[model samples]
Target: MSQSDHDCLFCAIVTGERRGHIVSADDAAVAFLDSRPLFKGHVLVVPVRHVETLTDLPHTRVGSFFGRVQDITSAVERGLQAAGTFVAMNNRVSQSVPHLHVHVVPRQRKDGLRGFFWPRTSYGSDAEADDYAARVRDAL
Candidate 1:
């Protein structure tokens, strides 16, 4: 095992060496409720292997890892009867854990979840956000 794997909490959870409230598991990934949840139904989806960042995750495993996240995102919304869901990942900054975890946060309209950035303001326009999206998409 690599040094990171030896020191990794998520890896221990994935291997069953550490106890986690595992909600789902498969060959490619694992899904579990967050120890500290954004909401009751909040879940953290992670790759079965120890990958510290999205960019570090193997491209071959991307589909499987995110497929599980997508499944859990839907389940979080449906099970909690949330109006919507906020799915996000932090590469390194603001990441409480070292593992690559995708947070599936349940959301409702006007749930007071605003200001998600540094004195953050909402996008000036959908077009502006779309321009950012287009840049990212073009890169991909």
Candidate 2:
């Protein structure tokens, strides 16, 4: 797919100019583990095309992109054995990265991820980090 550089992280990721903890990838989209996860199994699904926001893309692309997102969500739900999944897309305001990507956060009851109220805490040690990574990798 064609892309423009100009402040687009997803484009870099798609082109292999940047690194991310990718889970699944197809011709149209890629799914990766979130660096700063809302939950243990949080993942991000992004289209190959570079669109600043959801509204910026064409309807066909949007539909296809979301379809991919749904597929990833299902994988995350089953793989992680999650009680549920929270799928979200950010526009201009919530757009941390300019690219149009969807978040698929695996949720469990009493996991303390309810409603995005809890603050994220960094891993205490390398062992803890590795353990978390292993868990997520297993789910993928």
Best model number under lDDT: 1
C-alpha TM-score for every candidate: 0.81, 0.75
lDDT scores of the candidates, listed in order: 0.88, 0.83
Tell me the lDDT of model 1 at 34. 87
lDDT string for model 2 (1-140, tens) is: 35355557777777777898888877778888888998888999988877777777888777777788888889999999998998888798878988878899998898775575447779899999999999999998
Which pairs of residues clash in candidate 1, taking residues 3 or more apart in a chain or in different chains?
none
Compared to the true structure, candidate 1 yields what TM-score?
0.81
In model 2, the Cα lDDT at residue 60 comes to 77
- Whole-model lDDT, candidate 1? 0.88
Give the lowest summed-lDDT range of ten residues in model 2: 1-10
